[model samples]
Target: DLSINGMWTERLEDSCEKPDEHPTPLTKQQLEQLVRSLILVEQSQELRILAPEIKVLQEDLQLKKANVYRSIPYSRFGSNRDAHCYRKAFPYLLAFKVSCQEWGQVLLRRKEWDAVLEHSLMAWLYTSELPQWDTASHNALREQCYGVLAAHILTALQHCSLEPSRGHELLRRLKMAQLQSQSIVPCIQELQRILGWAQHLDCDL
Candidate 1:
């Protein structure tokens, strides 16, 4: 009788603690509030991660801008030159360089073979603005930057595993532009040499 009573009590407690067959419905306001709270939490988390990235980006941009400004010649252009030519060219040149570097970095990260080819061609377009010499030294810093840009393009082309006809066109334009710069024979020669190497790349795909 004692054992039977214990068994009966256990069964009663089990049934009482069991979940209901039908669940209670949440109110519309309650649902909305829950969603809003979740959104706030998610946004707060994203802000925490993005804030530091944004700060780093701002610092990098300031450094790049300063480098560009330093490269500009403060002396006025020749008597025959337009007074505002340098002023007009300065900002555009800086913007172009920054865009080129950032885009190159993106291509390096993506390793998109075709895009790498496209970037390589785009790089030549910017090369025109890079005079062999500017402000003191061999422009070693600038050249290194361009070299890294070139490497990224090369790596992307290699990893993308595809043909780069579109990239070929960009190189063609660069070659033509370089040819037109006959006064700067060395620039033309250097560009031609680079172009030759770029043209012969065997894409993986």
Candidate 2:
């Protein structure tokens, strides 16, 4: 079924000439179906086989402009609403993000930077989707995740400066997060100073 979804994307891209003529929007059920498919696909140990499916889902997500991160669809889980509801309710989308983060840590432990960046970026995509921006716990998690994100960019910058492709990729994402997230992790100041060619760290001044 995901393969069918993949083929549909290829067909849609080839056939549609105008924005208005693009494929119909996926129904709520289809959205959930596709999101669930990706979550399961990424969980597999056989990433070699599942990689294409994840790529298809990512492409489909971009084409649709479908944001599973922001809105929580409560009707999807009527059987045990209370169980899923934490201080703020956790949606299927949050589960998808958390799943990505889990796999990302696994990749990080193996020092697979590209793979780590892919999943870490996916997980970072949803950090802005948390319901309460000013809440204490949310603020803490946001800072922590952004810190890790900066480390990813800085590490890439340190290693990939000569071949700057992936470093630039991480740099772009870092700027986006710096703008989008209301606060930055403190250590990111050092990164900014380096980028600015400053001679001294903030502590020295």
Candidate 3:
């Protein structure tokens, strides 16, 4: 139990920090600017980050409107205010998709590929709750996912082949090469922990 607890604690330390993001309160002027800029601006890579953020912002904004309309007595705003807000947010949301396509070249760049892949996967996985990005984006999305998996598999073999000192050296190289990205080892360890828990429950069953 002591050893198990130690491993779990270490895993928590290794996991990525949750991003600190807040809703972008678009002013009337900002909204106009965004609409105008959408065409000529060329916002591909930015959309990779913005698409997810906008989804969350829209949801929050919808809830806020709902709270006001539902709570205000004798208000003409009606219970459907939230739905109306969502309609307004739709064009901007679709713009985000076009933006992603626009930035395809940036995403495909060798230096940014790893980060783009990881970011896109997170966007797709969380789409239901927020981004609402279309399933059509899955081709590039799956390619990046498979690329990461393949890289990890290769790393796993290299890790096993190395002496202890050489293994550490190889890991250092990966961290540098991958822009200080978190490693496959900790991710694998977390998977093992989850499987271990499932097995224990199965035995109990």
Number of clashing pairs per prediction, in order? 2, 0, 1
Q: For candidate 2, which ten residues in a row score worst on lDDT?
A: 80-89
Error of 3 at 23 (Å): 31
Model 2, 71-174: lDDT tens digits are: 23355635322323322233233333434444454455555656555545554565554444333553454555555554554454343322345444554565
lDDT by residue (tens digit), candidate 3, 54-78: 3443342344223323332343655
Q: Which candidate should be chosen as best, given lDDT against the real structure?
A: 2
Model 1, 1-205: lDDT tens per residue?
A: 1111243224422332233732554343443343334333433444444222333333333443444445455665452123343332333233434445554554455445555555544454445445444333444434544554555544554454433564455445544644423322232233334446534333400
Compute the lDDT of residue 35 as modeled in candidate 2. 47
Poorest 10 consecutive residues of model 1 by lDDT?
A: 1-10
Q: Which candidate model has the greater lDDT, 1 or 3?
A: 1
Where does model 2 exceed 4 Å of error? 1-88, 91-97, 133-162, 165-169, 182-205
Estimate candidate 3's alpha-carbon lDDT, on a 0 to 1 scale: 0.35
Decoy 3 TM-score against native:
0.27
**Each candidate's lDDT (Cα)?**
0.42, 0.44, 0.35
TM-score of each: 0.36, 0.44, 0.27
* Candidate with more favorable, higher TM-score: 1 or 3: 1
